[model samples]
Target chain A: MALTRNESAPLFSSDTANTLRLIAYLALAIALMVIDHRNGWLVQVRYFASAAVEPMYRLAALPSRLARSAGDAMSDRARLNTRNAELERELLLAQARLNRLQSVRDQNERLQQLLEAQRSLDLGVQLARIIDVDTDPFRHRVTIDAGARQGVAVGEAVLDAHGVMGQIVEVLPNTSTVMLITDPAHALPVKSERTGLRAIARGNGALDSLELQNVPISADIKPGDMLVTSGLGGHFPAGFPVGTIGSIRNDASGMFAVATVTPSAALDRSGEVLILHNLPDPVGPPAPAPAEGPPAESAPANKAPNP
Target chain B: MNRLRANDWLFWGSIAACYLLQLMPLPQAMLPLKPWWLALVLMYWTLEAPDYVSLGRAFVLGLVGDVFSGDLLGEQALRLCVFCFILLRFRARLRFFPMWQQALAVLALLLNDRIVLLAIRAADGQLVPAASYWLAPFVGMLAWPWVFLLLDDARARLRVRDA
Candidate 1:
C-alpha cells in the first residue's frame, strides 16, 4: 500500500483531536437523552435495539432453560409419577371449581342480557416466560419471550397464577417488556370488591405495596377488602384480582385517605406470566358518582374495555 | 498472516467471552456479586494492546451493552467512553503496575463507573439503588488478577504473534 503521509494528518492525530472527539461523543449522548426523554424520539430506535439484542436474551436464558429441562429429565420414575398424580388431582379440583363457575357465568350472562350491559370480558390468557428482569431501583420490569409476534401488544395486562402482575409497556419483534405494577410510573384502576369503592392504585416503587390516591376519608373501604380491576377506562379487563388492601390511613389534612395494598401476585418470583392480550370490550366509563354521593376520583385509563 | 489473525482472535475472543458472561442471568440473590465482566475485559485490552481497541470501539461496544442491558440510551456509552479516556491517558502508568496494584486501579475505575451510574440514575429521577448495587465493583476488583492471568495464559499457550 502506498502511504500518502500529509501534514494535515498530524492535526487529526494530535492530543487535542482526541479530546475533541471525546467532547463530541459526550455531547451526542446528552443530546440523545434529552431528546429521547422529552419526546420519546428514540423509542422506535430502542425497540429495534431491543430486537437486535433478543439473541443476547436468548443466550442468557439458555443455561436456566437447560438446567430446568435437565432437572426434569433426571427425576426418577417414582417422583415423576408422584408429580403427575399431584397435577391430576389439581386438575380434577380445578374442573370441579369450573363447574360452579359455569353456572355463575350463565347467570351473569342472563342478567347482563336483561340489563343490556356490554358483554362480559372474554379473558384470554397467553403464556410467556420471563427471560430477563431489570433490577433498576426506579424501574421494575421484566422482558418476556412473547412479543408482537405472539400477538402481545402494549397496554395488555399480565398476570401470574395468583393475580394481576403488570402491563406490557413496550413490545419488540420477538420480546416484550412488562412494567411491573410495582414500578413508580405504573397505575391501575381498581375498585373494592365488597363496597364497589373505586380508586387508582399507583406503584410506590416498592416491592410489597401499591398506594391508593385521592380516596376520600368517608369512603367505606377497609383493610382486608379485596380490590379488582373495575375495567374503568380499560387498561385491564374487569374482575381480575389486583390486590388485598393491607392498610388505610386518613391523611393529616383530614379530607382524603391513603391506603396501601399488598400485591396479590408474587412480583419477585414470577417465572411465568399470562398476558391478557385483549381487554374484554370495555363498557364506557361508569356513571360518575352523584354529587350528593361521595366524590370518587376516576382517572381515564387510556386503553381498553371498562367492563 | 495466520499468526496475526490468531492474535486478533485472542484479543477479540476474550472480549466476546466476557460479554457472554455479562449477559448471563443470575438469580436475584446473586445479582449483586456479578462482576463487571465487560469492563475488566476492556481494561485488559486497553492496557495490553492499546492500538487495537480505540475510543470509538469502546463507545460502540458500550452502546451495545446499554441496549442489551435495557439501560437508558447512552448511559453505558458515556460511562465506557470516560473509562476508555482515563485508561488511554494513563496507559503507561497502569501498564507497569504490579498485578495487585493493577487490581486496585481497576477497583478505582469500577468505582468511578458506579458513581457515574448513580449520577445518571439520579438525573433520570430514579430512586437511589440498594447497598447491593455497590457490591459488583468489589467483586470485579477481586476477580481482576485471575482474569488477567487467565487471558495471558490462554494467549501465550496459543502462541499468537503480536500485532
Candidate 2:
C-alpha cells in the first residue's frame, strides 16, 4: 500500500500531535535551563551525563587517530627519516641538559629543605593531561584527565611547560575543567616583572590575547613587558610567569590605557599541564590573642618551666 | 510487504544515529564545521516521510540537542519547533523543488535558526559577535545537499524492500 493520509482526519492529525509534544519538550528544556542557571542543581546531572558520554568520545577519537597514523605512513619517508635523526640528536643534547639540571635541582632542593625547616611549610605538585577542549569556543575552558580523585581541587593554578595557563574552575570525580587566562570571565592579578606596575590580567576569549585592564595611561608600561601573577588574591601563587605585553593603546577619552598581553604559555596547544597545589592559607592563624600584659610579665611563672 | 515497519525502524534508527554523531568527539578544527547533523536528519525525515515524522519529533530532538550540547536548554527546542513547523507547512512544495533550490531553502532555515540562537545567547549575556557565529549556517548549507541525498537513498531503499 502506498503512503496516504486519511482524508476524513483533520489536517492537524498526527503531525499536530507531534508538534504539541515538541512544544511541551521545549518548555521542559527552558525550565531546566532556568533551574540550572539559577540554582546549580544540574551540575551533578551534567557530571553523570558527561561520564556516560566519555566512552563515546574515546570511540570517536580512535578514527581520527587512525587517520593521522595512515597519513603519517603515506607521506615523505626521506623527510621523516631526516627529522627522526635530528630529533635523536636533539634528544641527546636534552638529556645532557637534563642531567645537569637534575644536579642543580637536587642542590636547590637541599637548600629549599633547609629554608623550609627554618620557615616550616609544605609544598607539592600534580601533573594532569588535557582531555577535552570546551564545546563552547567562546569559553576558554579545558577538561583535564585529573580530578577530585587525584586531589585536584578547584582554584588551583594550572601551568604548562612555559608558564601559567589558568586555574581549576570545576572539579569532578574523574575530570576537572580549567578556565584559561583567555576566557573573558577569568581575571588574574598580575604585575609587570620588568617595571613592577600592577594590573588585573583579564581574558578576552581570544586564542593569544589577554587584556591588562585599569592601567594608567602614564604608567611605565610598554610592549614586551613581562607579566607575572601578583599573588594578591591568594588564589594563585606569586611570581608565576603569566604573559607579556603585546601592545598598549591609550584611550583618547580616558586616563586608563588598555594593554594586550600574549600569554607566556602555549595556552592553545598545551597537552600536558601541572596543577600547583600549593595554595596559601587564606587566613593566617588567627592573630595570636593580644596579651593583657607584657608577655614577659604574663609568662613569668611558665618561663621557669620553659627554662 | 514489511515496508512500513522497515521505514519506521530506519526513521527511528537514523534519528538515534544522528544524535550519536552529535555526541561524538571531534577535534577543534572539525568541531565547528560539524553541522547540526541531528537536525538535518530530522529535517530529511520530516520532508520525506511526513506520515512518520512531524514537528513534535523535531522539537523533542532539538531539546535533546540542547541537553547534550549544554546550551541554553530550550533554545534548540524552540528553534527546532519553529523550523519543523515551517518545513511541515511547506512540505509538499519543498519535496517537489530541485536540489539546489531545496538547499537554498535549507540554508535560509538554518540561518534563521542560528540567528534565533545567537539572539537568545546574547540575552543570556554571551558576547558572541555576529561575524563568527554566522559561519556555522554557511557550513550547514554546504553540507545540506549531501545529507539530503544520503537520507533520500536510505528512504528509497526502505521503500523498495517494503514493496
Candidate 3:
C-alpha cells in the first residue's frame, strides 16, 4: 500500500545527464528572454500562449459576471424607476450638448479643409469590456474582450469616460492586452491646454502620479493646467483629455523641473473602455512642423530644445 | 483495469484543479500573498511521486507557467527545472520528513525560488519589487501542510495502489 518509489537502487542522484539538461534549459530560457525582448520573433508563440490562457481568464471572470447579472435581475422596480429617470435626464443633457457640438464639428471640418489638411474626419471607437488585470507588480496592464479578430490592432488608443486610458500593446486572437497609462513603460504626448507647452508624461510605476520630465523651470506650465493629447507623436488622437498637472518640483541642478500629474482616468477600476479604432489624421502637412509632435518612439523624448 | 485508470485520472484532475486555482484572481492588496500554487503542487508530486514527475516534465510545466503568467517563454521553465532538480536530489530524505519538517522544507524551497525570481527580474532590468513580493513564498509555506494533508487523504481514500 506504500506508494513510494520502490526501486532497490535509488534512481535519484546528481548525475551528469541532469546537470547537462539543467545547463541546456537555462541557456534556452535566457536565449528566449533575450530574443523575445529584442527580436520579437517569438510573437507567434506568445499569441498561441495567450489564446491558450484566455479560457482560464474567462472561467475565472464567469462567477463575478454571473453575480453581476443576477444582481441586475434582482433589482426592484423602485430602483429601476429611479435609474430610468436618472438615465433619461442624462440622455436629454447629452442630446442637448450633441446639438451644439454638431455645429462646432461642421465649422471645424470647414476650417480643416481650408488648411488643406488630410481628412480630419471624426475619430471612431469601439467598446470593449476589461476582463482581467495583469498581476505582475512591475507592469500595469489589462486584458479586454476584443482583439485582432474584432479588428482591434495594436497601438490603438484605449479610453474610458474620464480620459485617455492607454494603448493596445498586444493583439491576440480573441483578447487583446492593454498597457495602462500608469505603466512604467508607457509615455504620452501631451500639451498644456493654456499655453500649448508640449511635454512628455512618463509613468513612474505609480498609479496616482506620472512624471513630466525635462521641462525647463521657465517653461510656461503650471499646476491645474489640463493636458490634452497634443497628437504630436500621433500615437493617440488629438484633443483627448490626458491628465492635470499636480506639482512642479525644481530639480536640484535647477536646469529643469519635474512635474507630477495625476491621470484624469480612474485607471484602477475595471470597466468598459472605448478603443479608438481610427485616428483622425495619420499625417499632417509639413511646415515649421510645429504641428508635428515628437516622433513616435518607444522611449519618451529625452530632450526637446526650445528655440 | 478501469479501477487502476481512475487513480491516474485523479492525479491529473488535481493538477488541473491547481492550475485553475493559480489562475484565480485575488484582490490587489492580496496579490503579493497569493502563493505559487503551481510550484507548490509541482513540489508535492516530486516529493511523493518522483517516477511521474521528471526533470523534463518539470521543464514543460514551467514553460506552461511562463505562458499562463505572460512572462518570457523560458523564465518559469528555468525556475521550475532548477527547483525540480534540487527536489529530485533531496527526495530520499524529503519523502520521510514529518509534516512539520516538510513545511520547513517547503519554506526553504520557496525562499530559494524568490532568489531565482529576483535574478530573473534583475536580468529584465526591473527594479526591486515591492516588499510584499517576497511574502508569497511564506504564504506557500503556510499552505503546504494543508495541501499535503488534503492530497494524501484523497490518495488514501481512492485506494489506488502505486504502480
Structural RMSD, model 1: 6.5
Tens-digit per-residue lDDT, B1-163, candidate 1: 5655676888777767766677676666776788878788888877765545577888888877766766677887888888887887777678788988999999999999999888887888877776778888899999999989988787677664443
Quickly count the clashes in candidate 2.
3
Q: Is the docking of candidate 2 incorrect, acceptable, medium or high quality?
A: acceptable
Reference-based lDDT, residue A243, model 2: 87
TM-score of each: 0.80, 0.80, 0.83
In order, the Cα lDDT scores of the candidates are 0.74, 0.70, 0.75
Docking class of 1: acceptable
Q: Residue by residue across A1-307, what tens digits does model 3's lDDT show? A: 3244335334444452277788787788788888877877676887877767788778766766777689899999999999999988877876666656666556755776788764333344678888854535457788899988898988998888678899998888888889999888799999898999999999887777888999988998889999988887767867678899999998778899999999998787777887876543435554524233222220111101100
The best candidate in terms of DockQ: 3
Worst 10 residues of 3 chain A by lDDT: A298-307
Model 1 Cα lDDT, one tens digit per residue, A1-307: 1123222232233352278788888887777767766787566886777656787778767887788789889989999999899988877876666656666667865776787753323345678889854424346788898998888888988887667899998788889889999888788999999999999999987777999988988899889999988777657766778899998898778789999999998887747777876633336754433211111111111111111
Please give the TM-score for the first chain of candidate 1: 0.72
